[model samples]
Target chain A: MREIQAEEITSVVAEAIKNINFHIRPDVKAELQRALEEEASPLGRQSLQLLLENAQMAAAGVLPLCQDTGTTVIFAEVGQEVRIVGASLEEALQAGVRLATREGRLRHSIAVHPLSRGNSGDNTPAVVHYHPIPGKALKLFVMAKGGGCENASAMAMLPPLASRHGVGDYIVNIIRTNGAAACPPLIIGIGLGGNFETAPLLAKRALLRKIGEFSPDPETAKLEKVLLRRINELGIGPQGWGGSITALSVSIETAPCHIASLPVAVNVECHSHRLTEVKI
Target chain B: MSATWLKLPLEPLVLRDLKVGQWVNLSGSLYTARDAALKQIFDLEADNKQPPVDLKGQLIYFVGPTPPAPGESVGSAGPTTSRRMEHFIPALIEAGVSGIMGKGPLSQSTVKELQRKGIIYLAAAGGAGAFYGSKVRGATITAYEELGPEAIYCMHIENFPAVVAIDLEGGDLFEQGPKTYRKET
Candidate 1:
């Protein structure tokens, strides 16, 4: 088995966490550029212009893409044949995130408890999900999720009898009522067909996909297009001030589920889609 | 069209003249607070107590900014969602707040109170943190310093770009702006 030092894992996460905050993803930036060209409303166009300028400033490293540097989420895919050294995997991740939050000057946004209102101070204890893959390679996908959009995320288990249009309607309703507050032109990720917990995970994972890339499943790909149109048609627009481009893209992921359950989860990502990945 | 540069101590006349959908540049003293800080003040008020800062005629920006980098006025300071703080608007208005600054449309109750109190609601560009963070002239933690990013901060801001999202007349940009461009698919 190949052994990787825990310090290496921490430093990698440290660098990635800091950098992703400073720069918006290129795919997301390109979508914003396209939105600027296609946007119809005068105000929508102006908002897009400000976002583009913000991107330039952020690229200069003067400031990060957002202030609410948000909850740090990491998806670590570890090779089954590899062993981690120096510290436990979870401890390494926590230490890495803490180091980056302090040195990188990212905001410490994690709270200790819902009722106690204690700040973690160093932005530690990041939510981590581990997947085992074959071989001696380890990969990490990191996201700095902002509160406004994450607060808008939801999950529901629809009746298996619910039609595809019904599923579409439920998703649209979620955006119509909750989308504006989350920020827009949103990158919406929908997870369909998994069990309760799995569905939401699938949805969150869907958000990490490249913006505007359709799913391999033809039906899922078509559903993505349909939802994108239906959502943009809501006229929710950028920042919910209103316009033709309410959503930049709708990405979906699916998994097999129980025969009686048709679970769905939606994760709304704001225009400042901070995502990055690394392999080692 | 000429630009509107509003300085501190915004008079009632200026507030009245402002309408939904008009963009304005603000330069003056502002306070930054979000969920926790607002909740503290709300609880304080419920007990017939006073908050640390005098909110009278001041605008409260709903935000939790990163600590400043060296030689910079602030770190990426941008607006957070306003809806979460909607319930605190009345207490803030009662304390004589003249304006609210944040992103997204507020609920009807919040809008109604703003209209009644003639408090201006403004939207700084959401996700445009780098630009808005530069506009902050100075920032000092005023309350809840232990809360870190969620602390109440008094910020001296200049040339901060904001649109009049709601005004004294009950007109709302969030409602009107989107309707003008709605397309049936």
Candidate 2:
């Protein structure tokens, strides 16, 4: 077994958390630039320009791209071949989050409880999900999801008879109601055919996809295009400032569900769309 | 006549146009407080004790900035939801806060109160943290160190760009703008 020091994991995780807040990923940047060219709405085009400018400023001067640095949601793929030597893996990750909150100067957006609502100043413990993988390197996918886009997310359980059209209608309605509230030119990530909670998770996972990239399945890609076209028709515009392009792209993911249940979920990402992945 | 219009940034258009949201930004003073800080301000007022900072015609940002690294002004400074502080806004307005800066919607009650009190709620673009951070030329804590990120920070700003969400006359961009564009589906 390859031995990896827990301290090393902690340090890497800390830097990863910090780097994501301060920098926009190259892939996301490229996509924003492309969207600027394709966006027809003069207002959307302007909003995209500001977004690009914000990304550039944040990257160069070490400013946070958006104010809501958000909670540290870390997706860890642990290598079965690697053994952590010093501290507990969970503790190490939590430590990394603490360091990021304190040192990185990222916002402490996490509340202790949904009902009681107490602030957890350090933004810990992180929402860490671990999966075993056959490799020597640990992969961490860190995303800082702001509350605006997060608030726009929807999960619904439709009957088996729910047609593709029905699901599409629901997704469009969500964006229309959300209006400028979700910070438009959003990335609409849709998940179809999964259990309740799993469906939302799948939708969020779909957002990890690079902007404008398509699903491997032609059917899913076609559906994505249709949804994208319908959403932009709503005229939500950038910052709700008025525009033609409501969304930059749409991505859909699906997994088999119970024969009786047709579940659907939508996770909208604002223009900032902050996320990054690191392997160590 | 009851007076309450010392609030400099009057409306969304005026605020940006008058350069209240412009560069030169601000150098001398500003106040930092959030939900909890507002409560403390009111609590002190209720007790007939002086609130820590003087908010006369002063700018107050509704932010709980991240902890600063060694030798930094402040980290990732950005506005929090103004709607959350709706309950405490009237009191703050009455107490003489000139400008309120935050993101998202303000409650109708808060909008009415701002109109009555002649105050304005500014909407800094949400998720424009880095852009927002660039305007903060300097920062230091003046109260509630225990509040950490939510502590009262005295921030110096330069040409900070923010849209007027709530104006002195009760016009709110967050309300009127979206309501205009909200399609009947």
Candidate 3:
């Protein structure tokens, strides 16, 4: 068994939160560069240029890449052979986020209550998902997901007979209608074949994949390509100002499901696309 | 293509000349507000009370900037989705606000109201908050300090860039720009 100290987890989480906010992942940056060259609209191209500059400035520590440093969404895969010392995993992660929010000067965006509309002040209680893996190591994926893009996410439970094209159509329609609001060019994450709740979770998890990387499954990879082409053709352009590069990349993840259902969810991410992974 | 440099508290005539798809580099003073600030303004107006800041002939940016790092004028500040503020826009326009700056498209009814009032809607690059925030020369929270980042801030900006997404004549670049390039595949 591998024993990990809770302070170690806290430090890693804190560093991940702070670093991810200031830095755009290199793969996502490369995609933006490609979009800059390929975009035909003058305004769209200009938007991409500014996005690139923003990434550079953010990395230089001038400011975070986005004002909405985002709701901290963490995915942890803990091995059964690993044991945490001193504190619970959840408390450690929350403490790390709280420290990052203070040290990084990030906005306190979390509302204490959804109805009463109270501010959480420290941006604590990260939305965390945990899965048990077989190895002795623990893996963590963290994303600072902006509210604009989060609000644009959608899901549908289609009839069993709905073809792959129908799924593609639904995804395309959601982007077409809500793409601008989410901030294009977007990174699209799709979850297919899961039940209702898991479908949305899978969709969001799919976004953790590096930009431009395709699923290993051939059929799923092809679907990613097709959907990428279809979404870009929507001409929502960069920042939805209009152009040929609406989406930078499309990633899809799938799981087995009931015989009567085809549940799909689309989670849209903004161009900032701040996410990082750590293993211990 | 070419960006036009303009100063804020833009005149009605100056706003009338802006068309959808035109780039602008704005400078001068403007007020910031988001969902919470807008709601407060609406409530105060409904109660026949005046807001803390004047709305007449001013520009308002829909943004909730991150807290500034030490010695910085502002933190990464960019336009939020404008659709959420649509309901408050007509009221703002009626109060004599000449221009709105945000990201994404506004509702058709909001566009109509903007046209009726001869105001314009500009879109800054979403997710490019760091770049935009750098343009802010000064910022002071003007109202609703309790709302934290959502509070109203009077900001002095220099050469802040945006595109005229909706014009005074009601030309919506969000619709027209896409239609111009969309391939009917």
lDDT of 3 at B105: 85
Highest DockQ scorer? 3
lDDT score for candidate 1 against the true structure: 0.89
lDDT of every predicted structure (CA atoms): 0.89, 0.73, 0.91
lDDT of 1 at B39: 89
- Where model 3 places Cα greater than 4 Å from the true spot, the runs are none
- Least well predicted 10-residue stretch by lDDT in candidate 3 chain A: A53-62
**What is candidate 3's local distance difference test score?**
0.91
DockQ of 3: 0.83
Off by over 4 Å in 2: A38-47, A113-121, A135-137, B1-29, B39-59, B96-99, B106-117, B166-185
Candidate 1: deviation at residue B161, Å?
A: 0.3
TM-score of each: 0.98, 0.82, 0.98
Residue B4 deviation, candidate 1, in Å? 1.7
Residue-by-residue lDDT tens digits, candidate 1, A1-280: 9999999999999999989888888888899999999998777888898999898898887588888888999999999988999999899899889988988888888888978978888987799999999999999999999889998989899999898899999999899889888879999999998898999999999998999799999999999999999999989898888899999999999999999999999999999988899998
User: Which 10 successive residues of model 3 chain B have the least lDDT summed?
Assistant: B87-96
What is candidate 3's lDDT per residue for A146-210, written digit by digit as tens?
99999999999999889889999999999999998898999999999889899999999999998
| Model 2 per-residue lDDT tens digits across residues A1-280 | 8898888888888888778887887877777777678765553465577677788787863567776787677788999998988898899899998887767667777789886667787888688878899979888888888776788788889888887888898888888766467767688788898899888888888888888898999988988888888887665666654456678788899999999999999998887776888888
Q: Considering lDDT, where higher is better, how would the candidates rank from best to worst?
A: 3, 1, 2
